[model samples]
Target chain A: MSWSFSIGSISGIRIRIHLTFALFFIWIGAAFWNEGGMAAMANGLAYILLLFLCVVLHEFGHILTARRFGSQTLDVVLLPIGGVARMKCIPEKPGQELAVALAGPGVNLVIAAVLFILLGSQTIMQDVAQPAKNVSLLSQLAVANIALAVFNLVPAFPMDGGRALRACLSYRMDRAAATKLATRIGHILAFGFGLFGFVSGYPLLMLVALFVFMGASAENNSTQLHQLARRLRVSDAMITQFSTLPVTSRIADAVALLIHSTQHDIPIVDGVGKPIGLLTRARLLRALHDLGADGQVADVMRTDVPTVSDRAELEDALRLMDEENFPAVMVADQRGHLIGMVTLENLDQMLLLARLQPRE
Target chain B: MSWSFSIGSISGIRIRIHLTFALFFIWIGAAFWNEGGMAAMANGLAYILLLFLCVVLHEFGHILTARRFGSQTLDVVLLPIGGVARMKCIPEKPGQELAVALAGPGVNLVIAAVLFILLGSQTIMQDVAQPAKNVSLLSQLAVANIALAVFNLVPAFPMDGGRALRACLSYRMDRAAATKLATRIGHILAFGFGLFGFVSGYPLLMLVALFVFMGASAENNSTQLHQLARRLRVSDAMITQFSTLPVTSRIADAVALLIHSTQHDIPIVDGVGKPIGLLTRARLLRALHDLGADGQVADVMRTDVPTVSDRAELEDALRLMDEENFPAVMVADQRGHLIGMVTLENLDQMLLLARLQPRE
Candidate 1:
């Protein structure tokens, strides 16, 4: 996000520009100007920008279809290689995934067809085959689209082609199994691309290969996490037995506990035992350093907390934790009272257990 | 990690090879065989393998220096691009960082020096210039080493050159300010490189630009988080007045609470007001689906919890949570009691507040 900025939006989805993506245009302009003066630079910039627009349209094709299946794409980011649609959640159904995956390349194919008609196939082919002369902008655009379509259809992980393959395989096996197979295929394809690029000294192909390879691995891990989420519950991994502090205690009291107790975070409660705030060990030292140990517990304790019922699923808890980027959540009972806590460690244990004994 | 396998270990640092990295050789062998026959194939593979070994050695130059400064490196992974040392915690001291940053390039420089002496400058240049034929493997190696050193010295994020620049800048300004300046310079440099790559049609330069740009942003965020961790405590953001559940509660009771309470995770406590376990919201629904609402809370709640003293630093708590991979951790007071909770949501508010009021 730091390297990208919002360009605009399509409906609710924001279209963003990666900083380097914009730089690519400026780079093209500067380099072309150095080589062939202003006219060539202008032509080059125009050509690059048009190609980018086509890539954006291709991403939209995927984004729009995904939206129909309740997948919300937050951003469409433009990079040199292609446009990436950042969808936080993808539809799980294989049928829907197949449609979503195919939509992008499908758009490119249509664009190529339309451009070919507009430019005339004979003239377009003539322009496409030549690099120095008789090249129409239309033909170049058509060729770019066609290349995008063909390249995307190579069938590998991290690509539309790979997703389509996974979707098809999912019909015969489980989603995870299908994804694993697809990811392997993607790796092989990426290796092929990278090897070809290295020997031929083509950086573009090498970068593509890296992306495909990394994507395959990352996708597999994400799918595995999803499966774990579905099969587990918060109760399966919540931690019990921790220390607490009274609301009347001062920073000195908390510090004393920090030295004596292994606990680095203490929950503070009122006289009647209703929770009021939490004081972490770091806060304790910080307070001692800044406010002195005399600082009242009420003044230093954190009071903004969220509690969850202990009967919840680990999946929802994991989602909540991810969104919060926090390590722990408190658990509550039917009477709306704090009873336990769930930490990232607990979740890891549960995940490990589930992985080891999936049927359990 | 799924796409990488450990070949062995040096001291404690594991040497891992990315799957594609190994496949690159196979790809070279097959591609070369098709294009130039056995002699060419053998020569090509030998050249690539030797280059990768240099890269690995360059990485060792970094890892050894970092280890001396107490930064633990778990893996040194080889890829076609280069070698990556996965250092968990980088040394923060400006001098240490500078040393760690320069070591890899320094090693490359040394290798170049030694190779120059071995191959003789005249022969090396001839071999490096005409890579297609009349190439001495030794001369090719010297050129590769020199190129590596030169490329890595380009001041940018995600690269050692940028780190070195930042380290130098840190002496004149605050660490945060220095990083910001360095990042901007890195971005501009990345843009320049990318432009040059595009114009000259060099894919390697373009990928390096992308890595630099992204690394700058990621590094800045990480540094800011570290700063925040030092200045803030769990108390600054711990949520208070949250709901809790009693140990005696049943799944049906939790169901009642779930419908009425906004809390998703419920902490369960004993009669004397001591925490026993935590149940998450997802677990509530899952338990209902799997075990019915009549199931006992004692049987389903998570009990393996870790507690921290309320006086502990938020940084420590954050580390604990990260290691635990949990959503929440219980806060304990002097009496070893769970008085409050800190959830990921609370941490977010704290982080947001800290960012807004850095001085505070």
Candidate 2:
């Protein structure tokens, strides 16, 4: 996010180029200049730009298909390796995942087919043997599209082919088991590809191998986390008991309360038991440290505490809590009365349990 | 962790190899086999294995230094890129961090020095210009050590030089400001290195560039989180109010309670207000679905719920909660009475707030 800047927007999704990608352009230009001259440099850069264009189209295939399946596309980032369309939706139902997975390569296949029709097989084959020579750009691009489709279909985890495999497997097994099987298969393929890449002295192929291996493991963890989220609700993970301060209470009382109770951000209520403000631990400490302890709780407590309904999904509640600024979100019942609170520390426990006691 | 397994341990720290790394060896071996037959294959494998040994020793430098500062190392992992010594203890105090940072490269410095002495500088100089020639192993190793030392001192984020820079800067300013400045420097260096790597055709340098750029952002985020943790206590992050189900409650009552309240993991209390067990939302739902709603709360509840003191640190409580399998941890007073509960959803709010409102 820091090194990348937005280049443009496509149907509401921002297209950003990472600094590495930009610098890569400069490097490619320099390399081409040394190889031939300005004309060659221009030619090489054009080829690369058009190639990345194809990559973008491939990414759109995944993006549009995922959107159709009801997942929101946040951003479209173009990198040296490929493009990424990040979304947090969990429509991993076997059928939906299979569709989304095949979409990217499906686009590449379509491009290859269109190019073959235009170029004719004999013309494209001429450049296929030695692409670096003064060959037609269209032919190279057509071959590259074919390569992209074939490469992506190699059943590597996190790749379209791997996802397709998992989806197919999920029809007969649980998602987790399906993922485990697909990931194992990915690992084996990664090993073979890496060996071939290393021996052949092609770093990009090795990079692909690394992606497959790492992607397999990362996807494995994510799948497990999603499985955990599927069964849990917000109330299941929110605390039911805590202490609060009163408007008439002093900073001294808040400090004492902090020292004695687990409630770091104490809700300040009036005589009728309505929260007038929230005194966060950081503010309380800063207040005590900066001034005397005699300040009224009403004068120091934060008044903008957000609230969520008790029956909200754990996933939704987490999203709300993450999007809001309050240290804790007040949990309220149907009557809109504050029944409890949720904090980051509380949810961290679930993460711990998820890691330690991984469900089969 | 999923793809990696322990190879061994050093001074209680487990040494693990990621699956990618293991597969990388296979790739290298195959590549060398095709390059120049069996002898060349053996030579290639030996060089790679020894090079990674240096990487491991370099990691040990950080692990040992960190331990000296009272930090614990959970594992020493051998990655394809390098090695990672994972530890959570924060001793980001300027002087201490500088020492830990330098200790790693310092190990390489010593290795190079000792190897130079053993191989003789004049003899090592012959292989320096072309390391792939039929040269003595000792001479090549000496040069490799020098390269290791120099590369690591590049002032890249998460690298020793970058951390040393932050430590030095921290002497004059707060850590957050120092990290921000150092991270910027790392970004610039990464760009320059990436450009050079791309033009000069060295993939390893490009990898280092990626490391610096990604490391800068990650370290920046981590530093901010630490700053947040440093100012807050457990009481600050804990939730303070909610409802609990009594042992006499039935599954029907739990269903009703779950529908009405935000508390998901309901504490089952006895007549004296002591928490005898905890009824997690998942279990309650599963019970109501499998059996009839007439099942008693006491008949189907987990009795292994853990407890924490009210005045504990947020960091410590989170760690404890993560280590235990309980859906929620009971917050108790000095007299050992269950005064409150901490759930996973509760702590999620703090993480959200931290990401939203970054403090300087």
Candidate 3:
């Protein structure tokens, strides 16, 4: 996922081209070029490009639909295998998810239909069916669209059809259970594809098989983790006994406190016993190295940290922390009173416990 | 990274084989089977499998060396293109990093050397070179090892050579700047490979080109972000003031706190003024839905959350939180006294500011 590049943005959704896609085009061009001339090579290249454009549009269909369901699209990256639309969050509602999943292949279907109608009206059915050695660009594009629609319709995880199946099943069972079922179906499909590709001598089909298998497994794991996070709450995993420091404290006093206490983070509180900021060891070291022991705590305290209530959803809080790239959060009470602090270490301990616990 | 399956652990490092690697074998078998018969298919399959084994050994070389430098390897995943060893952390010391990176290609060199020596002693070089159009397994394996070593030495990120280059440069320049330099060189190599592949009609070369391009770009981005994180601290981005609830508080009290204070998590403190646990809104709702208003706050509170010292490193804190899967971490002072809480929202704000801040 990290090893990709964004080409541009279309309708606010970023479009990325995977590095391997270029190899696909190059191979296609070379394999066909020797049989004809520059025209044949160009034609093959054009067809591959057109196919990928359709793939991009298909991904966009999912992106736009997900957007409507209150989810944000991170980006759509094109790989040699296919395009992937990274949705920030999939909707919990079965209907919304189903609609989003269907939107992709639906766009491809429309493209194929339009092409079919055009070819039919022009009496070019024969040319469309058995494309000539040097096929026309329009006919090639049409055929590619049709192929795209058909291929994507195969039930496989990371494929539109598979997603649709999962969404539908989620309506009957819990999302996690539905995902598990979908993964099972995906594995079966992967085996089928692998067997078919080996028998048919189509290497691309093998790639599809691999994609489906991996995607299904990833989806299952992510869904399970999310379910666990949803069932838990922030308070269920926070550390309570911590330390604090007043803003008026001197560097010498902070140092003395650090020497006597096990805490590393010193929360700077105001005269009214309200936390105003925090002073970390890194900051203290810099201050000590630059201004010596006489410097005030307020001079090095940071005030841009996030705070949370003691009762927020654990999953939501974790997600927020991950997205914001923060290390810790401050907790408060009903009267805006500083109570305790939480950090990444406390979260890890909880996760470790959860992992060690016997499953129900 | 997330699209692979772990096979088992080897020398304390997880071994994962991507589904695509299986596809690679299937494709080789199919291509050869069509060209000849079952024997030819078996020959091709054996060659590919042996080649991948060499790839695994190459990755193990990196892993073993990295271990010596106090870096833990998370896993080694085989892809269609090659193998990837995901290390827990890269050594900052230039010498150690350089040694670890060079270890990979060193394994390939040894394999090739061993094969050459065996062939020479057995006087089977000629027979190995021509095995009636099926190709000898030993000969093919030797050639593949040599090829792997050379290809990986082409200086590209996500590759052994590129890391070696970065390590060497890091000694003289900042890590981020060295990464940028190496990435530039990698891009140049990628373009060169693409051009060569286009003219020479080699699909594999084209694939390598794409891999280099994407890998370099990713390395550049990751290094840039890491540099930023290293320069910042937790105190620079934690939130101070927040709402909470007492340990004796009732469900109705929590609901009122949620409504009036907009606080979603409340820390429950005992008579000794120590935080005993946390009462989150999700738990409160579940308690109310299951046990009614008579449920005590202590009965629904969570006791296994993470806590952070006010002076902890921001990057370390974030990493711990991510690993632990904690929603929020409590911040404490020198006396193990509860100060405040830090959550994801505060971290996001800090990142936004860091990103938007004007450079001198």
Candidate 2 residue A259 Cα shift, in angstroms, is: 18
Question: Can you list each candidate's DockQ?
Answer: 0.06, 0.09, 0.05
- Assign candidate 2 its CAPRI class: incorrect
Candidate 1 residues A1-360, lDDT tens each?
299889888788888898977876787788789878998888888889898888988999999899899887778998766889988678779999999999999999999999888878999877777874358777888988989998888898779899999999999999988998999999999999986785676776887899899989888866766677777666655555556678888876776555333345677776655566767655665676667767887887666655678789877877776555555677767776666666655454344334433333
Q: Quick one: ranking by DockQ, best first?
A: 2, 1, 3
Ten residues in sequence with the least summed lDDT for candidate 1 chain B: B351-360
lDDT (tens digit, per residue) of candidate 3 on B146-246:
88888888677657888889999999999888988999988998889866764564556667788889988876765665566576655554544455567
The reply for model 3, stretches above 4 Å from the true place, is A1-131, A134-360, B1-49, B67-80, B86-89, B121-133, B184-226, B239-306, B315-330, B338-360
In model 3, state the lDDT of residue A211.
Answer: 82
| Best candidate according to TM-score | 2
The positional error of residue B130 in candidate 3, measured at the CA in angstroms, is: 3.9
For residues A212-309, write the lDDT of model 3, one tens digit per residue. Answer: 99988877766765666687766655545556787788877766554333345777887766778888766776676566777888988888767778
- Residue-wise lDDT of candidate 2 within A151-245, one digit each (tens)? 78888887888889999999999998899899999999998887676555566677778978998987786566456656787687676667767
- Which stretches of candidate 1 lie above 4 Å from their native place? A132-134, A241-306, A319-329, A340-349, B1-360
In terms of DockQ, the best-performing candidate is 2
Candidate 3 Cα deviation (angstroms), residue B140: 1.2
Instruction: Report model 2's interface C-alpha RMSD after superposition on the true interface residues.
Output: 10.2
Every candidate's lDDT: 0.76, 0.76, 0.72
lDDT of 2 by residue, B292-355 (tens): 5777988888887777787876666665554443556777778776677766555554553444
